[model samples]
Target: MRTSLQFIFLLVYASVAACCQGQEVTISPDVVYGHKSGLAMTCDVFTPEQDANGAAVLFMVSGGWFSNWSPPEQTQHMFKPLTDKGFTVFAVRHGSSPKFSIAEAVDDVRRSVRFIRGNADRFEVDPDRIGVFGMSAGGHLSLMLGTASDEGNAESKDPVEHISDRVNAVVAYVAPTDLRVMAKDAPDRLPAYDRFPALEIDAKSATADSPIIFVTADDAPTLLLAGAKDDLVPISYSRNIEAAFEKAGVTSELIEFENAGHGFGGEDAKKATEAMVNWFVTHLDK
Candidate 1:
C-alpha cells in the first residue's frame, strides 16, 4: 500500500511539475462582432498567468482561405510554448475567402489585433510588446497585417476600432509572400484557382501588400521559418523577403530545414518552436 501510494504521488507530482515547468499561458476563444452588423468573428487569446506587462503574440491559423474548416488545434498549440516563456498570445480567426472576400478577411485579422491591444488591461499584455505569428495561410495573413497599415477604417464606432493594429515583431512559417505570383507559379493550384477573383494586384498595391515589399529600415523585426524542400512555397520567397530586409537595414533572420516540407511536425516542429521562442525573447524581452 505504501509503494502504491508513493507511485500515485509521483504521478501527480510529475503532472503538476510539467504544468508548472514553463510559463503557463492560458488560451481562451472570444467573439468580436463586426462593425455596423453584429456578424460574429472569433479570436483565441493565449495569456500568461501572473503576467506583469509581458509581451503578446497574435497568432493566425492556416486554412487556405476557406471558412468551412474550423480553427486547427495546431494553431493554439504553437503559441503555448511562447506563453510558457512569458508572453501573452492571441490566436485570431478571420473571415475566409469565398464566403467572404480576401479584403474583408484581412480586415478581420487587423481588427483582432486591435481588439487585443484595446483590451490590454484585461489581458495583462503590454500593448507595445505585441507581435504576430502564423503558418501557411495564417502566415500570409500575419505578413499582411504587419506590413500593410493603411487600410484600417478609422470611422467605425466599435470599441475594437480604436485600437491600433500595428505589430512590433513578426514570426512567419511558410507564409505566402506574393500570393498572385505564387498562384501563377503553382501548377496544381492553377487548375483549382478559380475560386479567387482575377489577380488584380497592381505594382503599387503588390508592393504595399507584400511583406517583402514592405521591408525597410523602419520595418519591425521579423523572423521567417521555411522548409527548403517545400514545393508549395519555394524557399526563394523567404530569401527574397530576407534580401529586402537586408537592403532596408532591418533586423531579420530566415531558417531553412533541408528535410522538412510544407508543415512541420515532431522534431522539425520542435526546432521551429524554439526558433520562434528565441525570436520573441530577443525582441520582446526589451
Candidate 2:
C-alpha cells in the first residue's frame, strides 16, 4: 500500500537529519560483473567514508536498456543522497537492447548483485543488505532482481554463480510491470519496439523469468513511484505490479503524481527520492 502525501513530506523532512553528516566517499573504477557477447559488463562503486551503514545499493541507470557508462565522476551526483545516508552505491550498466534483450539485462543485474555480495567484505559492506534501484527499463530489471533472486549453485565452478543474488529491497520508478501489457498498450515506449511483435516479451511467452510473472511473496520489499500522466509507460505499469505484489502479500507501495508525466523532476522528483531513501532505510538498515 502507498503512503499518504503528508507522510511522504514528513518522512523526507524528518529523515534529512539522519544523513551521514556530509561524509566523503571513495569510488571504484569500472569493475567487471560479468562478460557476455564479447563485452565487459561493469559497474562503478561509491563508498562512504563511514562505510555507509555497512550496506550497498546497486543502481541500474539504463534507459530502455541502452546504457552509456562513464567514469564514476559523471554519475557521482546521482549517488550523493545514498552516500549521505552512509550507503555504498554501485552504478551498474548492462548490454543494450535491439542487440541485446531484457533477458540479458536481467541476468546482468542478478549477476551484479552476486558479485557485490560476494565481495561485500572487500568493499566493507553488509552482504545481506544490498538494495536495488533504477528508473524505466532499469527499474524493470531491478524488479526482476527482487523477484528472481536465488542461492548460488554449490555445484558451479564459478564462485560468483554460487553466491546468492537476492537483494533486501527495491526502489523502482516508471517501470513496466507486464511486458505483455506494456507491448500491447504502448509498444512505442518499449525498447526495440520496432520489432516488438517478434520479441519474446509478451503474455504468450511470459515466463518465470519475466519480472511481473515471476513475483512471489519472497520478492523483496519494493517502493514504486510513477506519474499519473505518463503516456509512455503509464502509471498502470506500476499499478498492475502493485496489485500483483498485494495479491502475493509482498510489501510494496506505489505513488502516482497527479500532475506529472514521463519525466519526473522538480518537487515530484524530490518526493520520489525521499520515498526511495525512506524505503531503503526502513528495509536495508535493518
Candidate 3:
C-alpha cells in the first residue's frame, strides 16, 4: 500500500513538472488604468510560456452589480487551470456598479483587453487571438467585449483611450445578458441592495448596451454556459443572447447544465469548465 501511494505521488509530480517546465509564470498586479483619486484598476497576468504566440484569455471576476467582495481563490479556478494547458491568462478587475456605473465597468474591461493586446509583443501573446471569460456579471462583461465595438481609437495618451479591446471569442458562465430584463425581474434572486438604490431595468442605456442587443454576423464566436436552475442569473439570460446570435447569423453555442444553480461546483462545474476550454481551443487556439 505504501509503495503504491509513493508511486502515485511520483507520477503526479512528474506530470505537473513536465507541464510547468519552459513555462514563464508572471503574476503582475496593479496594472494602472488611469489617474483619479485612488484611481487604478489591478489585474494579474499569468504567462505560461516564453515561446507562446498563442491566444490569451482575460478572466473577469464575478461580483454582483454591487461593489463589496473581492474576487477570491475560486476565481482562479477559471484561469490558472487553463494556464497549465498552455495558454496565457489575465485576471482583470474593474470598479463595481453603483460605485461605478455599468458604463464605467464596461469601459474598464474594454481598456484592460486593449492594454493586453497592445503589449502583446511584450507578453508573447497573439494580438488577434485574445479571448475573454467570466461568470455572472463578469460573464456579461465578457460577452459585451466580444460583441460591442464601434472601433475605439488607438492613438490617445489616455491608457484607457488608446486601443480597440475587441476579443476573438467569449465564454460566459450564467451571465446576465439582457440587463433590462434582469434588472426588472431578477431583484428577488439578486443581492438586496438598500444602499445603492436599485436601478430600473430600463434605466440608462441597458437596452442599447446589452450583448444581446449588439450581436451581429461580424461579432466574435461565443460560448455560453448556463445552469438551468440558476436563480440569480437565470438560464433565460443565455437563451436571450443565443436567440439574438442566431438571428444575427453569428456563431455561438449555449450549454445548459440540468442540475446546477447560479454558481456551480462538483462534477457539473468541471464539465462546464471542460466545455469552455474546448470552445476556446476551437475558436481562439487556431
Candidate 4:
C-alpha cells in the first residue's frame, strides 16, 4: 500500500514517460551540429506527431552565456505550444561560458543554423522558413541570429558552411541588445554579471557582439518581449532596438509586462508564448 501523494507522483511520472516514448512528438536527441576543442556541439530535434507545418523554430538553450543540457523529454513541455502547432523545434546548445567565450557561443549557434539548413530536407522542414526563440542570455543570442546572420561562404571547405544562417523570424524575451553598454556598465551597476566570464569582453569585441550594432534593413522580423520591472535586463534595451528597427524600416514589435520581473509568470508567460507562436506563423509562412 502506498500513500496518496506517492501514488500520484508515480502516475505523473508514468504519464511523462509515455509522452516521451513517441506519443505526441518524435524526438531525436543529442544530434551533433558542430565541434569545438574536440567536444561536439549538439541540438535536440522535436517533430510534431501529426500535421507538421513544414516550418522550424530554433530555441537557444542558453543562460548567462552558459549552455546546459537536459533530458530531451523534460523539455517537451516548454516546446509543446509550438510543436502542437505543427512546428518542428530545435533545442540548440552552444559552447558554454568559462570554457567558451560569448563570441565562440555565437559561432557555434551560427554553425547550427548552417547545419540545420544544409540538412533541412532530412528534418522535413523548409530551409528558408526557420525562426528563433529564446529568453535572457538565450534571448540575446536569438537577436544575434536575427540581426547578424549571413549568406554562406561559397568557397568554404565544409559543406554546412555553404548554407546560409539567416532566420526568417525572431522572438526574444528579456534580452540585452547592446553588449557594449553591458561591458561598460554591467560590471559596476550589475555585479551579478561578473560571475559570467563571457561578459568580460573588450570594447571592440563588445561592439562586434552586440545585436543592436548589427541590425540592418534585411534583418528578420523581430518580436521582443520584456518585463518592465526586469532588473537583470532593462526594458529600455528592447525599446531602443525596436526604435532602431523602425528607423531601418524593419518589422518589429515590443511588448512589455509591467508587473513582471526578469522572468514572466502566469498570464504574462501565457501571453508571451502566444505572441511568439503567432509571430513565427506569420513570418515563417511556407
Best model number under TM-score: 4
TM-score of each: 0.78, 0.86, 0.81, 0.90
Q: Relative to the true structure, how large is the alpha-carbon lDDT of every model?
A: 0.65, 0.76, 0.69, 0.83
**Which portions of model 4 show Cα errors greater than 4 Å?**
1-23, 184-189
Candidate 3 lDDT over residue span 45-80, tens digit each: 777645443789887753554332234333333354
Of the candidates shown, which would achieve the greatest lDDT relative to the real structure? Answer: 4
Clashes (backbone N, CA, C under 3 Å), per candidate, total: 1, 1, 0, 0
lDDT of model number 3: 0.69
Model 4, residue 58: displacement in angstroms?
0.2
| Candidate 3: clashing residue pairs, number | 0
How big is the positional error of residue 59 in model 4, measured in Å on the Cα after superposition? Answer: 0.3
Q: Model 1, which residues run further than 4 Å from truth?
A: 1-27, 33-38, 51-53, 67-78, 150-159, 183-208
| Comparison by TM-score, 3 against 4, better one | 4
